[model samples]
Target: MPSQITRQITRHVLTIPAQGGKPARKVHYRRCGQGPALLMVHQSPRSSSEYTELMRDWAAHFTCIAPDTPGFGQSDPLPGEPEINDFADAILEFADALGIAPCAAYGFHSGGIILVTAIKRRPQAFRCLAVGGYAIWTPEEMRIFGESYLPEFVPQPYGEHLAWIWSRILEQSWVFPWFDTREEARMSIAHADVEHVARTVSEMLDAGEHYRAGYGAVLRAPRDIPAPDAVVPPCLISAYDGDPLQAHIDRLGAMPASWSAQKVATPKEHQDLSLAFLKEHADTAPCGALPEDGHEGWLELEGGLIHWKGAKGGRLRLHRPAEELADPSKGEIAIDVPGHGQSDDFDDMKRAVEASAEALGVSDIDWPAPPAGDADRLYPDMAPDRFGLYLQRAWQVARAEAFFAPWYEANAAHAVPLTPEAIATPAVHARALARIRAGAAARRWHDTLAQIQGETA
Candidate 1:
């Protein structure tokens, strides 16, 4: 057994041109470790962040790279409703753009289907695959799923879908179809942990309205097992006990000599065996150098990638300033707050701010107050019919002050060292559209605050 190695994980984005003359799509990815590359694809409605822990463990032996599949994270969705093969081809494009090939792969559920399809479409791109769960759904099941499983996941300003999302994630383990309320379909492993629910909600928020396209494609994908005569890369499909796909392993029936299926006692055991198998079949050598961390680029922190601009010197962190209007030249450092601009969001503001500060390589700095009465003005594009516009507006105000909101009063003293020109930096205008896109999360923040105040009062 190889000893576990610690490596600095890095996040970056690259734009890949569309097949036609359409605009390019930006793909965001996280990479770590220092050996042969292992590509990881996450389950639907999730991102590369899902593999952070596993990437850390596998980094000791492989250069683990996890990408946010299109439509699920920062990565852009397909030009139109994609077929499963299109998703698979996108993975190949992702690998080609990064210049890594003949690598091993791992995925979970929808991710498994995507990776398997990718390998089937381009056998030379991968040496082997380890799948956590691979569903082989029947026509009936597919019909049922296609109808309801992935309805348009658009944002409802009032967050009308919040309850549905919460219940769906919580009850998924308890029911086979999740929508089925029949007693016979209930499993024993149902859990309602707040933290877990919050995590799922955060990922869903990241996917927003586009999750339906990606997830729907997988549910509608062909579940064909390679015949013994077909040439395919080595593959291992294992599902942990109690996983919904555990029974589907039997549906795989007869697979090629290069493929194997098993039911693992636990997820951890499954991961261990899969990792070992991938390493055993890995054929490529590591790139020999770790990805460089840039001083003027994005940093992968706990929640999501934190975008930083300006040369390293006197640091000036902008608090919800219009990104386009504020000049990066005015300060040595500037950041896009989580849930704002190019940065990602967390369920909690304190954690977001703390991570940003750490990524900024600053202990403390001058905190400036945001311009008054600008939150609502910044989000003019929000739908008037949205029920939580008020809350979203309030959240925008709090978002501007999130760094200090957790520690100090919103109106507390915030020293202004820079001139009015600096106070009204143009960068603030750059991210207004980004802020509008994050209105759903602002609604979540509203719900969180209501709970907090209700608990205290």
Candidate 2:
């Protein structure tokens, strides 16, 4: 059995310039392992985190690079609702920007479509391609997806969207067109677990409104299979029996000489075959290091990915905040605490804080005193109705004010004000509102957990 030990993954950001003088946009990705390069494109509404297990498994044989495709995950969306070709082009640009070449690629679902299109347009960029599932939607299905499936997901002030999102992800496995309530289309894989629903909902939150662009593009993409006589790179197209795209193997009537399609019995089998195929063709050249985006970004600490926003070389390196949690000076660096802002949380706060400070190149011994007062005083203004939801949103806003505000000021177009109603503060500074919201949500989350534990006890 695999050891199941978590992989040491590092997050990186690369800003790539647009063609024809359009401004450059930031692309975020997670990289792990070594040896031959394998670009992993994730499914819609999820980030590179989806490939954690896969990356760890493949680390022994290859260097796995998974990027959050534009408009989904942490990557910026295209200028507008983009065509599938635009996404394909973005992948090529991403590769060029990173100076990675002679690569093999693997994509799952929508990710697979993007890679397939990328290879179709620029076959030489990759040595081989392996995809989990490739959908060939008919015009009618595309119309339905456009009309109902890919609706713009906006934050509802009352938190009603959360409930809907939870249900949507949970029932997606049970129904073909997730929105369709017809009993005939029900799937055997439908799950009703709350935790599973919550996990996907968190990812949906990360993608926000941009989910439409990525998912929509895939749904609307041209599903052109190469003619038998046409030339293309070596490719393996496989789908598990229950996957909707399994039937697409039939649609791929006259595949290129190098192409092969199969219906696998299980997901493990699909991945095993994919890894074997990619390994067979991998050249294993050492791709150049990822380019650095100057100032304001993430640092992977022992606890989790720490989101820091500031320039290095501050006069006085602030190890942590004092009781008041005051704003950083012109030369100060501020970080969102683990599980606080963009940083992920660890069960042990003290250890996480210590590790985070060290990762940020600050001395752990100089740790500042924590904020004073209890949880209620910290977030006095939060609505009692849905405190947890409000906190999560607020935490993101708080970080934006402290670290991102300066960056945004320099780049005015990137500074989007939090929705007044959603942030629950038309009068407060965006940063203050965020702090209040995070505090409230943290309290609620902890309180709920305690209650559940006590009941079970």
Using lDDT, give the best candidate's number: 1
Superposed on all Cα atoms, the candidates' RMSDs to the truth, in angstroms, are 9.5, 8.7
lDDT per residue (tens digit) for residues 1-457 in model 2:
2232325677778889767765688898888877777899998877787898899888777778998898776688888768899899999899888877658899999999999899888888988899998888878888888889977677654445555766678778889889998998887667666555555666677677888888888888889876677666789999987787888888777789989999999889999999999888777675556776866577766556766655554432322211112345676666655455456656665566556566656552233432323434333444322223543444444444433333224356545465644345322233433343244334543443344446656
Winning candidate number (TM-score): 2
List per-prediction Cα lDDT, in the order shown. 0.70, 0.69
Model 1 misplaced regions, further than 4 Å: 1-5, 288-296, 300-305, 309-317, 321-334, 337-367, 370-457
Question: Model 1 RMSD to the real structure?
Answer: 9.5
Q: What is the lDDT of candidate 1?
A: 0.70
- After the best TM-score superposition of candidate 2, give how far the Cα of residue 267 lies from its true spot, in angstroms: 0.7
lDDT of 1 at 316: 54
Q: Which lDDT tens digits does candidate 1 get at residues 1-457?
A: 3343346667776778656655678787888787888889999988998888788878788888898999887788887778899899999988887778778899999999999998888889998999998998888888888887877654443334545666677677678777888998898678766555555655776687788888988898889877777788999999988888898888898888999999998989999999889989997577554333244467667645667765555465655333321436554677665565556667785466566666566665434444334344433343322233432443343335333323123444643333444224232222323444455553433344345446656
